[model samples]
Target chain A: MSALLEVRDLTVRLRVGGSDREVITGTTLEIAEGEAMGLVGESGSGKSMTAKAIARLLPAGAGVEGSVHFAGTDVLALSGADLRRHRAKVAVVFQDPRAHINPVRRIEDFMTESLRTLEDVPRAQARTRAADALEEVGIDDPARRLRQFPHELSGGMLQRVMIATALLSRPLLLLADECTTALDVTTQAEVMAILDDLRRDRGLSMLFITHDLELAGAVCDRTSVMYAGQVVETSAADRLHADPLHPYSAALVQARPDVTSTAERLVAIPGRPVSAFEAPSGCRFAPRCPHALDSCRSTEQVLTGLDAGRVRCERAATLRGRLLDPTESPTESEETADA
Target chain B: MPDADGPVLSVSGLRKVFGTQVAVDDMSFDLAPGRSLAIVGESGSGKTTVARMVVGLERPTAGTIVACGRDRSRPARNAGERTRRGREVQIVFQDPYSSLDPRQSGAAAVDEVLRVHHDHDAATRRRIVGELADLVGLDSRQMSALPRALSGGQRQRVAIARALATEPKVLILDESVAALDVSIQAQVLNVLADIRDERGISYVLISHDLAVVRQLTEDVLVMQRGVVVERGRTTDVLDEPQHPYTQRLRASVPGPGWKPTRTLRRPA
Candidate 1:
C-alpha cells in the first residue's frame, strides 16, 4: 500500500534578526496508510515544527524547503480550494484545548462551524454529525454538552470535545501534538485509548508528537527520536525501547523514571538540550554522549540502515550488544558492583 | 531539631472552601523529621490548596497545621510571627518562570532570602549564597545569571536554593519538577534527594506523577475530589492499592508494555 503522507528532506528556516536560522534540517518521514508514527524529543527539537510544516501552519516570514506529499498530492503547492480541502482532510489537536477553543462559544457552535461553513453541510445535519462524534468519544448527554461553554467542562472533558470536533471532519490524517500532555494521567490514558480505538475503526493515519518516549512506544507502531532538530533514530517502538542503538536514544530512555522499578538514582543525560541555533557542526548529541569519540565531534553522521532500524550515530555498529535496556533491572551483583 | 514524640509537620481535619465549592475536605497527614510524604492527585483535587494553606498563602476554612512544634491554624498575627512561620516551612511552586523574579540574578535571589532570615555581614551573605548555589548544583555562571538567562531546570535550581536559604525544617515541593523535561527533571529530583539526605529536612511533595512520587517519597496519600481516598507506605499503596481511585491512578501511569484502557469506573 502507498504511504498516506510522505515528507522528504524537509527544512524549516525562520527569519531571526538579519540572518535565517534553521529550525528543522533535512527531516524525512513517511506514514503508511493507517499507520501511527510517533515523534519523541525534548523542547526545541522540531517535533512540533515538523507537524506544523506538514499542515502548512508555519508562522509568517518562515521559509519552508522540500516537499510534503499527502496521498500523492503536494501539500506545499496546494492553493485556494485545494489547500482548504487538504487542511480539512488533516485535522490537528494541540496540547491545550482551552487555548484552541473559544471561551464564550458553545461546544456545538465550535464543533459544527467548520463542517457547516467549509464543507457546506446544513445546520441540522452538522448538529447531528457533531452529536454522533461526541457519542463516539464516550461523552454522554451530547445535547447538553453542546450547549455548554468551554469553561463549564473540565480539562479532560474539554480535550474529549476537541477530539470529537477533530473526528467531525472525518480526517484521513490526525496530527496529535502532545494532545494528552496537559491532561492528568488517568484522563491521558482514557484519551489515548479513545484515539487508539478511533484510529483502528477509521483506519486513520496519525502523527503522534510528544516529549514522552514511553507514551510514544505504547501507542505508535514506529517511533522516531529527534535531537537538535533532526531525527537521530527510527525503529519499531518495541525494538527501540528494548534496545536503542543511538547513544542519545539510550540516554533518553535511561533518564525517565520507572514507577514499577525502584532505582536509587536516575541516569541523567549530561548537558542541557541544545536548539538548532546552538547545534554543533558534527553529531548533535556528541557533547552529552558518554561514548562520543573524536570522530563524533568532527564528522557528521547520516542515518544508516541497520538490521531492523536506522540510526544516526558513528559508533552504533561497535556499540551494538553493549547497550543495555534501561527499563530492565540489573542483577544484584551488578548493582552492588556499581555501588 | 529532632522531635521524638511529634512530627515535623502535621495537619488535622484540613478543609478549604471557596464560597459554594469545597476545595479540600477533611484532609489530614503528618511528616516526620528526615522523612518525605507525597500527596498525589489530579488538578482541582485540593492538593495544591493544602500546600498553600501549609505555606500560609491560603487561610484554611477549618483545621490546624502544626509545623516545627507550633500551631499555624490561623494566619500569623504580625510580620515577626509570619517570618518565624516562614522560617519553619518553605514552599517551591510549580512554574519556575513565574515563581522567580525576571530581573534578579540567582545569587541575588538567594541573597535576599539570607537578608530576611539572617542578620549577616555582606561577606557572610555572599559566602552563604555561593554555598547554597553549590548545594543545588548551580554553577557560578548560572548563579550570576538572571532567571530569564537560565533554562527551566536552572531557574528551578535557583528556586530550590532560595527555598533552602531559610534553613526551614520542612520543604514543600508543589509540583516542583512538573514543568521540567524528563532529563532535567531527573537531575532536579536527584538534587532534591541529595538535599534531603544531607540536610535531614522533611518534605511534603504535591504532584500528579506517580513515578516521581514513587521515586522521591516514602509515604503516599492519594486524594480525589478533595478527599483522602488512600494513604500508606508508598510501595504498599502503589503496589497493592485498596481504593479504586488509587488503583486507577497506579494503572494510569504509562510504562513499558502499557496500553491505554477505559477511564476509571465511577464509584457508586
Candidate 2:
C-alpha cells in the first residue's frame, strides 16, 4: 500500500534567542491510507514539532527543509486557497480543549462557525449537523448540549465536542496530539475507544502523539519511537511493546510502574531527557543508555532496516532480549508470589 | 508524645458542603505511622475536597480531623497553633510551578520554609537547605537556579524538598507525580519510597492513576460522587475490586494486550 502522508528528511530550525537552533533533525516517517501511526516520545523529542511541520503550523522565524507530501500534494508549498483547503483535509485535536475553544461562545456557535465561515452552510443546517455530530460522539440530548457553554460541559464532554467539531470538515487525517492525556483514566479509555471506532468507521488515517507508550500501543497499529528529534524505531505496536529494538524504547518500557505487579524500584534512566537542540553529537540516547559502547558515542547513528521497520542502534542485533534484563530482586519475586 | 502504635493521622464522619452541593459526604480514613494510603477517584469525585479538609484548606461542615493525637477539626486558635498543625501535616500539589515562586531558587525556597518554622541560625538554615536539596536529588547548581531555569521534573523535586522542610510526620501528595514524564516520575517515586523508609513518615496519596497508586500506597479508598465505594489493602482492592466503579477504573488503565471498549454510561 502506498503512503497517504510521507515526511522525508524533515528538519526544522527555530530562531531562539537571536540564533537558529535545529529542533527537528533528519526525521522521516509515513502513514498509509487508513493507518494509525503512534509517535511516542518524551518532551522536547520533536514529535509535536514534526506534527506541526506536517500540518504547516510552524511558528514565524522557523526554517524548514525536506518535503511533506500528502495525497500527491506538496503540503509545505501550499499557499492561498490551496493551503486553506489542505487544512480542511487535515484536523488536529489538542491536549486541552478548553484552551482551544472560546469560553464566551455557546457550543452551537463554536461547532457551526467553521461550516458557516468556510463552506457557507446555512445556520439551521449547520446547527442540525452539529447536533448530529454530537450524538455520534455518544453525547445524549445533543440539542441541549449544543445550547450549553464550554464551561457547562465536563472535560471529557468538551473533548468529545472538540472531536465532533474536528470531524465537521471530514478530514482524512487526524492529528490527535495528547487529546486524552489530561482526562481521567476511564474517560481516556472511552475517548480512545471513540477515536478508534471513528478511525475504523470512516477509514481515517491518524498520527497519534503521546508520552504514553502503552496507550499508543493499544490504540495504534504501528508505533514509532522518537529521540531528540529523530526517528529511532518504528514497528508494529505490539512488537514494539513486547520486544523493542531500540535501547531507549526498552528503558522506557522498564521505567514505568506496572499495575499488575510491584517492583522494589523502577529502573530509572540515569540522566534526564534532553531536547533535540541539546542532544549530544553521535547518538542522542547514548549518554543515558546502559549498554552504550565507546564507538556508539563517536559515530553518527543511522537507521538500519530490520524486517518491516527501522532502528537506529548499531548493536540492536546483539542487544536483543538482553535490553530488558530483570535485575536481581527478592522483593519482585515475593510480590509476584503474593499476587 | 503520641503512642507509637497509633495512627499518625485520623478522620471520622468528614463532610463538606459547598453552598447547596455536598462536595464530600461522610468520609473517614486513617493513616498509620510509616504507612501510605491512597484516595483514588476521578474529577468531581470529591477526593480533592477530602484532602483539602484534612489539610485545613477547607473547613468541613461536620467531621473531626486528628493528627498526632491533636484535634484540628476547627480552625486553629492563633498563628502559633496553625504553625504547629502545619508541622503535623504538609502537602505537595500537582502543579509544582504554581506552588513555587518564579523568582525563588530551589535552595532559597527551602530556606524560606525553614526560617518560617524554626529560629535556626543562618549557618544552620543553609546546612538544612543543602540537605533538603540533596534529599530530592537536586545538585548545588540546580538548587541555585530559579524555577524557570529547571525542567518540569526538577521543579517538582524542588517542590518536594520545600514540602519536606517542615519535617512533618504526614505528607499529602495530591497528584504529586502526575505532571511529570514517566521516566522522571519513576525517579521521583523511588525518592519518595526511600524517604518513607528512612523517616518513617506517613503518606496520603490523592491520585487517579491506578498504577501510581499501586506503586506508592499501601491502603486504597475508592471514591465516587463524594462517597467511598470500596476500601481495603491496595493489592486486594486493585487486584480484586468488588465495586463496579473500582473494576471499571482498574480495567481502564492501558497496558500489554489491553483493548479500550466504550461504555455509554457517563461517570460524572
Candidate 3:
C-alpha cells in the first residue's frame, strides 16, 4: 500500500539576483497507485506551482527546498542522465489549450514525439502508435487528425489530444491542471470521462488541480484544499464533501451553486486568493474568512491529523458545519439551511 | 413578465450574416425597461456577435432593431455607431485585462467617455467619474489605479464603472462576469443588479454560464450557432427546458451543486 508519488514539504521560489518570491510554500501531498487526489484552490493558490514542482519542470530561476519523490526516487535530487529518465515518469496537463500545444505542429507529430523521444522507436512504428494513442482518447479519425494543425481542431478536440499525448508517455502520475475549464460543459464532461476511464483502465494516478470544488467532489478519492500555497484541509473524498473541516473549505462549499435547486443569491467567498509573490501574514484566508478570531491574526496553523482532513486554524474543529453531499437528493433541512 | 405596456426594445426577425454563415438568425425578443435579458450559449453560439449587433458595433444583414420604438439608423457603415449608441446603450466585454486600456487609470477610463460625449469641464467630469466609480462600488481611493494594478474583480468593477459613466439606458454585457471567480462575479453582479433597480436600465447579458444568467435575469434566451432556439422565464427555461439544445446547455452548466457528472455525456 505504498503511494505512487510522495511530495514532501515542497516549496517553489523565483529568484531574481538576490530577492526571491516564494511562489508555493509547504505543499505536501501524495497520490497512491490507482488513487486520485483533488488539489483545490483559486487562481495563484500555488496549485499549479505544486503540480509543476512534481516533474522538476521549474523555470531556470525556480529553486526548490523540498523533495518530490516518485516511486521511492527523490526526483529533485536526480541529476542530468537520471533526471531525464525520471522526468518521463510524470507528465502535466496545463490549464490553457492555446499555450500548451505548438500552434504550427500537427497533433500526431506531437503525440509521436512524446513516445519516440524516450525509446527511439522507428519513425513508421511511432506513427501507428501515435494513431492508437489518439484513438484511445476518443478521437475517432486519428489518421485524418494527424494532418490537421492545433488551430484546426476545436478546444475540446485539442484538449483530447492533450490527454492523448499524456497517455502516450504512460506516466505513473498525470497533473490535469484546470484542463476542462475552457471546454463547453458537455465537452468538459466527455473529457472528464476519458480521464476517469484512463485512470481505471491504465491504473493511472492523477493530481486533479482546479478551482472547481464541484468537479473535485465528484471525481477525487481524496482532496487537499490549498489556500495561498499551504494544504489547509485534507479529507477523504466523501468526507470532505460531507463535512469540510477548514473555514475556506466550508466557504468553497457554501459558494458552489446547486444546479438542481433554484437559488435567489449564490454566496461567494469574499475577496480573492492572495498573490503568491506577496505572501500575507496570519492566515492567507484570514482577511476573507468570516470566522477569523484574534488568534488567526497572530498565529499560522500547521496542518494537523493526517488520518482525517485537518486544518491549521485554532477554530478549525469548532467550525463544524457540514457540506451537502451531492450523491444524496437534497433533504428538507439541507435545502432550508442553504436556502 | 410581459407587461401590458410596450417594451423598451423589441427585436423581430433580427438576422446578421457574415457571408453564408448566419451569425444571428431570426432572433425575436422584447425587454421592458429595467428588466434583464440573459442570452446564454457556448462559444461561437453568436452571443458576442448578437451583443455587437445590438450595440450598433455591427450592422445586421437583415431585420429591424426597434429601439425606443424607432429603428436605429442601420449602424452608419463608416462611423460605427458605438459612440452614438453610448448615450443610450453600452457594452462591457469578457476580459477586464483586455477590456480597459492598460495605461488609462480607472478615473480616466470613466471620464474619457464623458469628455468625448459631453463637453463638460474638468471638475464636472471628475465629479461624474467619482459618481460612476461609487455606483459600481469602487472607492475614491481606487480612482487613480490602472487596469493592470487592480485585481480582476476590481478591474471588472472599473469596467462597469466606465460603462455606467455615460449614463446609458441599456447595458449589454458580453460574458463580463465569465473571467471572474464565483465570489468576484457575485460582487460585480450586485453592482449590475443595483444599476437596473435604481436607474431602470435594461440589461442584455451574454454568457456561457447558466447559473449566473439564471440567478440574475428574469428572462433567458438559449443560442446555438448564432440562432436562439429557446426563450422563456429563467426559472421556467431551467426547470423544464423545452429544446434539446437548451436541455444539453442546461445539463452542461455546473449549477449550485452540479459536478459535471463525469464531464457530462452519461458515458456514451
Candidate 4:
C-alpha cells in the first residue's frame, strides 16, 4: 500500500549565531494510510523538528531541503491556497494544551475558529460541529464545556478539548508531539485510548513523537528510533520491542525502568545525547554504543533493509540475537523467583 | 508507640489547608534509615503538599512530623533551629530549570550551600564542592557552566549536588527526574541509588510515574484527593493493588504488549 505521507531526504538547517547548522540531516520517513508511526528519540534528536518541517511550521531563519509528499503532492512546493489546503488535511497537537490554547477564548471559539475563518462556515453551524467534536472525545455536557474558558477545565479536560479541536478539521494525518507527556498516567492512558479509537474510527494516520519508548511501542503500529537527527532504525512495533537490531535502539529499550521486571540496575547509556553539530562523522551513536568497533567509528553507515524493517548500523546483521532483550533479562526472572 | 530504633522519619495525621481547600488530609507514613518510600499520586492529590510539609516549606494545620527523633510540627522560631532542620532534611524540586539561579554556575551554586551550612575555610569548601560534583557525575568543565549551558539532566545533577551539600539524613525528591529525557533519567536514577548506598540516606520520593517508583523506592503510598488510598511494599502494591485507585494507577502505565483502555470509574 502506498503511504499517506512520505518524507524523503529531508534536511533542516537553522541559522544559529550567524552560521547555519544542520538540525535534521537526511531523515526520511513514511506513514502508510491509517497507520500510527512512532518517532522515538532523546532531546536534540530532531524528532519534533522533523515533524514541524513536514507540517511547514518551522520558524524564521530556517532552511529546508528535500521533499515532503502528501497524497501525491509535494508539500514543500505548495503556496498560498495550496498551502492552506494542505494544512487543513494535516493537523498537529502539541505537548502542553495550556501553552497552545488561548486562555481568554471560550472553548467554542477555540474549537471552531479555523472552520469559520478558513472554511467560511457559519458560526451557528460551526458551534454545532464543535459540540459534536467534544462529545466524540468523551466529554459530557458539551454545550456547558463550550461556554467555559480554557482555565475553567482541568489539564486532562483541556487536552481532550485540544484533540477535539484537531478532529474538527477532519485531517487525514495527525502529528502528536508528546501530547500526553505532561499528564498523569491515568489521564495519559485515557487520552491515548481516545486517540487510538479516533484513528481506528476515522482511518487517520499519525506521527507520534515522544521520548517514551514503551509508550510508543504500545500505541504505534511501527516505531522508528532516531539519534542525532537521523533515523537509526525502523521496524514493526512488536519486533522492535522483542529484538532491536541497532545498538542505540537496544540500549534505549534496556535503559527504561520496566513495571513488570525486577532488574537490579537499569542499563543507562554512558554518554549524554549529542546534537547534530556535535555528532561524529560516522555513526552518530557510536560514541556511546557499547558494541562499537574501530571501523564503526570511521565510516558512515546507511540504512540497510533487514527482515522486519531498516537499520542504519553496519553491524546490525551480526548483532542480532546478541543484544539484550528489554523485558526478559535473566536477572529479573531470578529476582522474581527469589521473591 | 514508636519504636526506639524504628524509623528516621515519621509523620502522624498530617493535614494542610489552603484556605477552604484541604491540600493534604490525614496523611501519615514512616521512613526507616536507608529506606526509600515513594508517594505516588496525580496532580492535586496532595503528594507534593505532603512533601512540602515534610521539608518545612509549608506548615501543616494539623499532625506532627518527627525527624531524627525531634518534633518539627511547629515552625522553627529561630535561624539556628531552621538551620538544624535544613541539615536534617532537604528537598529537590521538580523543575531543574528554575531551581537554580540562572546567573550562578553549578560550582558556585554548590559553594553557596556549603558556605551557608558549613563554617569551613575557602579551600575546604572548594574541595567539598568538587567531591559533590564528582559524586553526581558532573565533570570539571560542567561545574563552572551556568544553568543555561547545562542540559536538563546536568542541571538536575547540580541540584542533587547542592541538596547533598548539607548531608541531610532524609532527601525529598519531588518529581526530581520527571523533567529529564529517558536516558538521562536512568542515569540520574542510578546516581540516586549510588548515593543511597554510599551515604545511607533515606529518600522520600514524590512522583506520578509508577515505573520510576518501582525502580527506586522500596515502599509505596498511593494518594487520591489528599487521602491515603493504599500503602504497602512497592512490588506488592504494584503487583496486587487492593484499592481501586491503586489498581487503576498500576494498570495505566503503558508498556510492551499493553493496550490502552477506558478510564476506570472511581470508587466512592
A1-339: candidate 1 lDDT, tens digit per residue: 689999988999988888988999888889999999999999989999999999899988999899999999999999898888888899999999999998989999999999998989999999999988888888888899999999999999999999999988889999999999999998999999999988888999999999999899999999999998898898999888888888888888888888887679989887788877789989989888877767889998898888688888978886664566444433442344334
Docking class of 3: acceptable
lDDT of 2 by residue, A9-65 (tens): 999999999999888988989999999999999888999999899889999889999
Per-model DockQ: 0.58, 0.60, 0.38, 0.55
lDDT of 4 by residue, A72-136 (tens): 99999889988988888999999999999889999999999999999999999999999998888
Q: How do the candidates score on chain B by TM-score?
A: 0.96, 0.97, 0.89, 0.95
As for candidate 1, its interface RMSD to one decimal place is: 3.2
Question: Positional deviation of A184 in candidate 4, in angstroms?
Answer: 1.1
Residue A64 displacement in candidate 3 (angstroms): 0.9
For all candidates in order, the CA lDDT equals: 0.90, 0.90, 0.79, 0.90
- Residues B77-173, candidate 4: write the lDDT tens digits: 8999899899889999999999999999999999998888989999999999999998999998999999999999999999999999998999999
Ranking by DockQ: 2, 1, 4, 3
Query: What local lDDT score does residue A226 receive in model 4, on the 0 to 100 scale?
Result: 89
Looking only at chain B, model 1 earns a TM-score of 0.96
In candidate 2, residue B96 scores what lDDT? Answer: 78
Query: In lDDT terms, how accurate is model 3?
Result: 0.79
Q: Residue A164 in model 3: shift from native, Å?
A: 0.7
lDDT of 1 by residue, B60-131 (tens): 999999998889989899999999899899999999999999999999999998999989999999998988
DockQ of 3: 0.38
